[model samples]
Structure formats: structure tokens, C-alpha cells
Target: MNIKSVNKLHYLIALIAVFTSIEANAQEEIITVKKDSIIPKKEESKKSEEDRNVMLNAANNTGPREVNIGLPASVGGIMIQENGMPVVHAFWPELPTRTWRQSVSLAKPGLTKLSEVAITQGELGFAVSSETKLGSDTPSYVGNISSSSFGWIKGDVNASGKIAKNLYYTAGIYANYDPQSINFKFTNWADRTQIYRAGLTKKFENGKGKISILYKYSKSASITSHALFRYKLDGKVEEIDGFKIGRDNYMLPNGRFKYLDIKSGEYKWMDAGGRDNESFAHTVDIIGDYKLKNDWNLNYLVRGRYSESVSFNIFPTGMTQATPESGFTVKETGEVYTGSANSMILSYTPRTPLKTFMARAEIKKKTDKHQWRFGLTESLYSVDNFTNNRSFYYQAAEADPRQLVRQGAATGNTDADGFYNYNVGGEHHNGFDNKLAVFGSDTWEISDKFSLSYGLNLRWEKLKGDHYLTPRTPGFTLADGERTKFDHDWFHIGGSISGVYKITPSFGALADFQYTENNGLLTSYSGNVTPNLPKTRSPLMGLGLYYNHPNVSVVTQFSYLTRNNYLTRLNLVNPTNSSQNQVETVYYDIETTGITADIIAKPFKGFQLHYLITYQTPVYKNYNFNAFGNSYTYNNNSVEGISKVLMEIDPSYTYKDFKFWASFRYFSKQYANLTNVLFFAPRWETFGGVNYKINDHFDIGATVVNFLNQRGVRGSISGAELITDPAPYNDRLMVGTFIRPFTVEASINFRF
Candidate 1:
């Protein structure tokens, strides 16, 4: 064998040896792996008959089962798709998923969170039904409440039981007060959230059919903040000299903001400190399953949701030198000429009311050697109305920044509140979209040691929208313009093929290949006048191996993916002239290759370690674009906002009824600007928690986030998209988001 092949074989042998040794040493003792409700593995057959019955009962009551397309799983974002559609649309404003129970697999490991939910080409588009536990046959109740050091309180309560023969029900409520709902600091904004949900299940007398109905109501109000920072010469995003990373922001002291109401043609006040952005949503779901003759079964689901939300935000634009010649006067206190820099403040608010409906039906048949499924899915998403408003003013760049009134003629004379009559009104549109797909898959058990699975999905989609084309001028009104219509439709196909081979009972190897194509939805077209958006094509290939032992388990995977026709919007500014700027829409492509290793080990009694490492190279390709008639080409630049290396190490110990765990996550440097000019330094996030079981009915726990006190700046830097050189920005401050500061939370839980 070649040297490289020999090296790989040696490594594999070493891994097996390590795990085998652990298994042999622990054979005298019993080791129980954590039960993951998501994965349905072959080992489940080893469970007891009563356990099997419970599992079957849970499935019969929880509506349709989740759809697995032989893909690798990931975390975060809309990893869970319901009926071939995302439960929450990625392009729209939505609330957090604290109360949402679901899981996700993105066809491959080590994919970025953005790529996980982008709904682009090559994705499996797997369906994971959001089934509530309300219809459980066993009676259970759980409640917990927690308060954070950051002055936030959160609590939840849930109950499930059997009400009558073949009848089950579940109910729950959740609430949070002044929580740090967003990535911004809790001290920067005020927020609240509440959710109420209930479900009922019924079974047929013949035991062959079942149905469940679920309802949910949720309401939330939150604020997102923008913070200013400076870029160091070494390409590090640093907090301003006196500004704190997480404890300080640019919001008004009392959280009050004044802006123009475009529809009413008058100025209005917004309470940024309290419920600045609000959302209300209602959802209803119906699900059914029936067993048919000849070993065939049918499962179906239907869901409808009505939601309305409004978001208001204020952020800073470009910065300029602060001087008397700049003609700056503080509007709030009538002071003049201060600070080393200044920037224009912009306000944006959008109100969206929408309705969505989805349906799916699948028929499955199981034979001695083959299992087959055929399914159909339909989704209808409509935006009843969408309206956005905007306003602009200027502000001094300093802690507790003050609004400035321009006394110079260069910038138009300002009103008493320092308001400028610039782009004060915003666009409006109404959208309607439909998607239909027919899919089929089969799993062939070729032998006890080998199996193959393949699936295909044929899809047809239509997007229709009516937009008001009027410019966002001062005093703009919805009735002042005529609406224009745009309609587009297309057909697409996607499929996946995978196979697994068992080298031994405890060792296995697998490979998967997938390809898919996608296009822009209503949200992508709403901001532009043209209906034609670029289509994207993505293809992914992966190879993996897994080894399981009595005390240790390891999974390693390698993936290569190439996706073209990425879409993004950039706000570009002239390097020599700060006043010369424009917003441009750009299209680019990316090629990524990654490897991941996940390991779980239990070296001794009541002690476990979970470790994961991912290394990836995601680079730009054909990234040529024009801004303000200037052509720029960035062929092999690293993709911005994504780290190349990520690692997670978690260790836990359980003694008696008490448990302790600590987790450490590390991230490599991440580029902040599209031009690859500035970047954020590598950082670490530490979390540790301890829990005590105070009996079968009560438990208490405490956890801390960012326990290492790493006040690092993360995420993309706003207003720096066009900066190719950082020399000019050394003295000027730019705005960027930051990681949460250190905070601790304690909670008590009870169950009956």
C-alpha cells in the first residue's frame, strides 16, 4: 500500500485498539449510554417488551413520524423541517425556539449554521415532525423556574396524562421576563416572551387508526442593539477605548426613540426599552395515522399558522472626523462640537402579517427484505401585507452617544430633534407562494451486514407578489402608488443515495451523495424590482466511520461541498471619499471541505467525556462584483463570518444523586468584512453547571455562561462591508455585534 493509505490504516487500527481496551476493562461493570429520543438505531431491538410497547404508544399518539433521508445531523437554526417546509421561515422575523422541540440533519457534518438552514441546493430537506408529548399514555408533570444574574427570570410548566380509554392530552405554558433573547447584551435591551400550547389524541376502537390535534399561541417583544467598535492594525475588532463589550450600547438611556410615521406623515415615539419589537402567532395542527392490510401504513399531517410581527431598529452609518467645521450640535442638550468621531443614525421598522399552511401524507410498506415509502407534500405561505418605514439622523461617536443637529449646509438643515428628511419612508409588498412535491424512497436490506437506501423528490414551486414601486420619499403613503405584480414558477428535482457496511458488529462504514437546486423566495425578491433572482446548485459528498464499544464510542466523517450562485446585499463606501457610498446586490460562489471527529468516552464509573473537533476550509469562488461602478474580484478569499476550526470538550461526573459538568468551546479567527480586510481574534466560551436530585420529585441546578469571562467581539462587523484596507479606519469606530458577557442562572424543578 502507498504511504498515505498505510498511514490511514494505522490510525484506524490505533483507534480500534483504544476502544477495545476500554471495553475489555469495563466488561465487569455495566455502562448505559444516554438515550437519544431522535435516533432510531438497531440497538433499540434489545429493549424490553414493555419498553417497545411504550415506544409504539408514543408514536401512535404523537402524529406522523419524522422523515429521515439517510443524512448526518447538525445543531441550531431551522434544522427541523415540517412536511418538507421549515416550521419557521428563515427569511422572516421570528421568535426564539426555547419551547420548540425538534432536531435537524443537514446531510453532512461540519456545515455552518447559515448553510444548515439556507434551504439551498444539495440539502436533504428532511422532515422532522414537531410532536408534543401531550398524548403520552403515562401520567407526568414537570415545572421549572430560573433567574439569571443579568436580571432575567424564566419559567415553564407542562403536564401530560391519559384522560380516558384511547384518549390522551397534554398542556404547557412558558414565560420569560427581561431576557437576553438576542445575541446583544441583556443590559442593552428589554424583552419578554410567553407561549401556551395544548394537544389531544384519540384512537379508533379497532386499534388501526389514530389522530391528534395540537394548538399553540405565542407572543413576544424584544429589542436588538448595535454597538460601535474600532479595528486594530492587526485585523482585530476591538471595543472602543472606553466602551464595554457587552455592558454598554448606543440605545437611548430611557429607551425612547422618535421617528417619522410614513403612513400618517407625522413623527411618533417608539419605546425601545420595552417591547420595541412585538410578535403574536397562533397555530393549529391535525395529524393522523392508519394501519392498512398487507403490512402497509398511512400517515398524514396538516398545519396552519397565522402570525403578525413588527420590528424597529436604529443603527449607525459611516463615521467622519469630528470638528467644528463639521457643524455638529447636540440636539438633546443643545451642546456643540465634541468627541473624536461621528456617524449618521438610521432607523428601520417593518410590519409583517402572514398566514402559512402545510400538509403531508406518506404511505409505507414493510416486507421481509425491503421497506418502501411514498409521500406527497404541499405548502402555502402568504404574506398578507408587508410595510417598512425608515428615518435618519446624525450622532456623536461616544459612550452614551448623543444625537447631533447639523448646522452646516453640506448636510441638509435638521429639525429640532436632529431628524433629517432622508429616505424617511420605506417599501411595501404582499407575497403569496406555493410548493408541491412528490417523493419516494426505499431501504433494501441486502444482507445482515449491508444495506442501501435511496430517495428522490420532484418539486414544483410558484412565487407571486405585488409590490409598490414608489420611492421611499418623505411623507410617502401606501395609497399614493400603483401596485405592480410579479409571478414566477419553476420545476426542480433532488435525490440522495447512501450505503452502509458493517466491518464487524461494533464497527461500520458509510458513504452518502446528494445534489439539489433552489431559487429565491418571496423574501428574496421583495427588496428588488426584478423577479429574476439567481438560482443555486449545491452538491455534497461524504464518507464516514463509526466504532462503538462498551465504554467508548467514536464517529469520524469527511465532507466536500461546492455550491454556486450565493446571493448577498452589501453596503459599499468609497475608500477615499466616505460620503460616496451605495448599496449593491452581489452574487458569489463557495467551495468547502471539512472533517469532523466526535468521541464519547466513559473511562471509569460515573464519569464521561464528550469531545468534538471540526476543521473546514470554506473559500470564495468567482466573487467578482461591482460597487459604484468599481469592479472587484476576490477569487480565493476565505468566506466571512465563519471560523475554520471549531472544537468542543465536555466532561461530566455523576456521584450519587449529584452531577457536575463543564463545557469548553473554541473557535478560530473569523473574518468580519466581505473584502477580507478585518477579522475577529480566536476566542473561547466556557460553561459549567451542577445539578442535585433532591429526591424523585424535586431537583435543583445552577449554570453559568461565558464563565471564563471572555469578553470577545464575534459575528459580522456592520458598516464595514466595503473596507478593503483597515489603515483608514484605525482612528474611526465601526459597529459590530459581541458575544454575551459572563452570567449565572439558578433553577429548581419539580415532577410528579
Candidate 2:
């Protein structure tokens, strides 16, 4: 056998042996591995059942299942798709599951409070979904999961009790931290997102009603993208390339560096700034519930939130490709920006700060034969933001951008006056966009077998917001020819009507016909033309059939989605002057449809298996826009970032506290960019693990991930707009991200 193979085999065998020996020793004691008892029973049966069901679903770690943070199962190894974003038009099984955080509807404020009761009565838990966890030092075990480098996850804790007669109190906290990955294989960034949040909720009831107050704080260090940089031997390289984009190409001076040195080595790569994303958000909320005579209940909520991206003068990282065609010159073998961060920021944001307020009220009536819910919601959103960006010119024509880093390297870019060369060519607009919205919904349980919910929403954009402007660049005055006032008024309507039908406990079907049209500043730029405003309009529908039995579970679903009047922003090289960039706006209409099938089975004792697969077709129906003194049209093309087929398989077994499992994740080959220049090969990863229950109070486990260390290229895809529009309008590229190499991690748990 090859030396490498033999070495791997030895480690694998050693791991398995160590785990088996420990478990065997614990087995001698004859102790059962079960959840610790945490209840002092009263009417606890229902609560216990709910907890068990949630735990079971969590263990599966598949679609619609929420990850519980407090459990050892949450740390790492979460099977995440699209890096860390919600699936577009997903399909689910017949059983009701919380696929994603349900929309926080102000009308159902009380329901949120009631759910917390379960937390207090049970164990503390946080759903670490949509975010990466962290790295580990040991081989993995059966339940340990890996985390994603980017995503929004919620961490929370709750407690409830009776402070006095007819007086009850409840408290909770919700916090989350976005997982930030140190450069993998190289200094190239693929995923770099930072988020910190802490929220406090207090609820205390009196004779009049139940009242709750909430306050939250949020901070974001930055949001950056890993660019697909061109690899060459020389250039005015601003940063040393440590790794290759979307591949396991080791770029450091030495051999492959593991996560071990990452914590200490991460800062060294900061010289090349990715897109800087710094922002803050503050929120305050008040909600209350009151019970009326008979069987009626009412709920009301008032909330206000303020948020803004920190204004900056530098992009730090290049806004686009650093290829020669983009004006950037590097003399080293690494990544550089073709475009300056300053120019990009000018085109992205024209506003300073943003604010929002929401108020809502809901009422419900329940009887033996019928249950009805009705509610209304109103909100206001506004933004006032702008930007200033300049360029730093290089004076040393003798310097090479591609030169690798030198310990004592001295930059020779100082001008005669010891001042830096600063060039100005960016956009600037001073304006405010305010939007008002009102919505209402009704939910009716018509019968035991069928139920449905419907809602309507209205939005008025730029109703009464102030407008102003400055020159696109500093030191330049705007003539009467340049339009600066960006103000307009428009209205939109949206709503949804969805229903469920159940034939039996084991058989059911679901159908949802939903459409939404809204207007707002969900963007960095607030420069809307008075006569031409951008709005978001999306319509989606889905149908599913499921059959559930004691031994086997099966589900099939089909869904269709369309995005029209979607907002598309672009940064373009100014045709009037190649030295600068021109920000452009375009709109496109898109359509997509897909089907998913899943099966979970327990063919025999001590064994379980799950299989899921999906097939999809996403395409751009039409794309026409005018920018840089030219109008262009793109023919129908398969939208980038969407794969035709994907699947996952999980199998596990347990025998008297000794457990083992294997999970497989796979995706078909796909186009990394819309134009299809960058191709992404099909990729898959496998993880094998074993867990040993070392006598009830303590346990240890080990896991081997990507044991084969398949160096497959994989990453998120984007359209040409991410760069300059129409340059390669039909193209797409996979940024810096790849399947990790074969690795092993181990962990232990203690219960008191």
C-alpha cells in the first residue's frame, strides 16, 4: 500500500480502537444513555412530548429541522447549501416543520411569548441555523456538525415563573455571531461576514394584561466577498496570495497549513481588504396581550429600529477584478483589485443612515366549531446616506505588484511633499427615501381537515421624503444639466392565500399560492430617478404530497417561482472617461421551478437511513438595460448559481450506547457564472463518526470528515453585474471557496 494510504488507514484504525475501548469499558457498568430528567412533573406530558419531537427532528439535521445550539449536536458539521443563505423556493414534507424562522408577524405577537413557556419548562436551546459554528481539535463523533462561514443564526435563552398570585414573569435573551472564516489555503477571502447581536426581553403580567419589552443591539464589522483573482507570476500585487480561489491550492510558503495556525496567522492577510461591510442596528419593541370575555384574545405590538452602514472613504479591497483590463497593475503572484473600493462605494450607497418603525394589532376568537384570527400592521422606513471615495496613485513605476511579501519591505510611494497621491472620481447624491406600508391578514380554520390563511398589503414609496444632491465627485460643481433630486411617489399591493389539507395522520397535501410586491431601500444606493423608481415584485406557488408511517416516511413536492421588476445594480467603466466608474441600474425578469423528494426509513432496529434529492431549472426570461451610453439585450440563458440536481444521504446505527453514522452530501456540476466562463465541477463530501457513552455522566466521540480530501472546486456563483455591467454581461465566476480537505475532529461531553 502507498505510504499516504497506509498512514491514513493507521489513524482511522487507531481512532476506531480508542473509541471502541472506551465504550466497551463503559458498557461493563450497564448504564442507559438517555436525556437527563429536567422536569418536576405537573401537566408535563405534552411539554415532554414536544421536546422529544423537536429533538428527534434536530438529530436528523435535514430540511425543515432546526438545530438546537445548547446540544453537542450543534457545534459543527451542519450540512449547509448555498454557503449560508435560505434556499430559493424550497419544498418540504407533509409534516409541519419550522423550515426557516417564520416571518415575525406583529399580529401574532402573543404566540411568540407562549412558545417561550416551552423553553422555561424544558432545556435551554438556541437554533444555530444559517451561521457557521467553529473549528475543533478532535476527530468528529456521531452528532457533531461543522458550521458555515457566513449566515444569520439565533442564540437565545428563556426563563419563566410565578412571582406572586395572578402575577407571572418571563425573561429571555437572543444573540448571534456570524461565523468568520480565516483564509483557507490562501490569503484569498471567500467568506467574510461579521455580526454581533444581543437582545433582552422582559415580560410581566398584571390584572390588566401581559406586557413585554424588548431591546436589542447589533454591530457588523464588515461584509466582504472572496474574489476570483487571476494568478500570474508578477504584478503590483497588493497582497500575497496564500491560497487559490475555490480550490485546495496551498499558497503559503510552506506545506499545507491546517486550522491549527489560523487563529494566529489570520491578521497577516488583512493587507488586502475585501469589501468592507461595517454597520450597526438598534431596536426597541413593546408588545402586550389581553384576554376578553368568553374566548376572545387581543394582541398589540409597537416596534422601532434604526440601522446604517458606516460611511467610509476607501473600499480597501478592489470593487471588481484587478486584471489589467480593469486598470489595476500588480507585480506579484497574488490577488489585487482591478477597481478601487472608493469608486465602488460611490456607486453603491448615496445615503447616510436608515430608520424604520412598525405598529400592529391582532384579535382572535375561538369556539368548538371554528377559530378565526384577524390582524393589521403598519410601518414606516426612511434613509439618509451618502459616500466619498478617492484613489491613491502609485509613484514607483519601478515597483512590481506581484512581489511576494518581504519582512522589511519599504513602500516608496511618497510624493515630494511627503503627502499621498489622491485622485477623485466617484458619485455622490444627497437624498432621503421614506416608505409607508399597511397590511392586514385573516386566518380561518374552516374545518378539521382543511384550513387557510390570507393577507393583503399596501405600500407607498417616497410619499413625503426630502431630496438633495452633491456633485458625483469632489471639487466638481453640478451644472443644471445633472439631475440631483431623486424623489417620486408610487404604490404597490401584495398578499398570499395558502391552505393545507390532511386526509389522515399519515397522509396529507399542501398548496400555497403566494405573491408579494413591495418598495423600499433594501440597497446601499438611494438614488432613485423621479420618473423611474425600482420596486420588488415576486410571485411564488407550490404543491406537495406526503405519506407518513411508523417505519417509513416519504414526501414529494413541486414549486414554481418568478421574480419580476427585480432590482439590479451595476458598476461600470465610464465610457466618457475610462479612468472612472459609472453606476448603473437595470431590471430583469426571471422564472424558476423545481421538485424535491425525500425518504426516511428504519428498516430494522439499531439502524436508520434518510435520502433526499432535488431537481431544478432556473432561467432568465429577459434582461434589457441601458448603461455607459449603450443599450444591450441578453438572450435567454440558464441563470447562474443554480444546479440541476443535488442530493444528501445519511445512515446511522446504535447498539447499547455505541453509535456510528455516515453522511453524504453531493451537488452536480454547475456554471459558476451566468456567462459560464468559470465552470464548477460536481462535488461531494462524506463524514464518518462514532460516539461512545462512557457511563451516563460522561461521553466521548470521534469523526473523520472528507477523509479522502477530495480537492474539488466549489463556491457560490454570481452574474456579471457583480463586476461592471455588460463587460461580460453573460458571464459568471466562482469566488474563493472550496471543499475542505480530509480532516478529523474529536470531542467529549459531560452531564451533571
Please provide, for model 1 over 1-752, each residue's C-alpha lDDT reduced to its tens digit, 9 standing for 90 to 100: 11122122222221111100010000011111111221211101122211100111100111121111111111221233433345554324442232232211111111111111122222433223334554667888878787878666767888888999999887888776754423342234355667787888899999999898888787766555556677775656666677776666565554555666655656677665554466778888788899998889998889988887666556455676656676778776777765644444444454467788888787888788877877887778888666555555666676676667776656445677766654433545678888888877777879988877677777888989888666545556666667888888978777766667888887878676666767766645544345336566767677788877778777787777776666554545566555444545566777777777767788999888877677777778888877656788888888777777877688888899988888777778888777788888888767788989999999999987778876676656666767776777664577765656787779898988
Best by TM-score: 1
Candidate 2 lDDT, tens digit per residue, 536-596? Answer: 5655566777677778777676767665554444444443442344445555666767676
Q: Identify the candidate with maximal lDDT.
A: 1
| TM-scores, each model vs. reference | 0.83, 0.59
* Alpha-carbon deviation at 394 in model 1, angstroms: 2.6
List pairs with backbone clashes in candidate 1.
Answer: 122-516, 134-170
Q: After best superposition, candidate 1 residue 405: deviation in angstroms?
A: 2.2
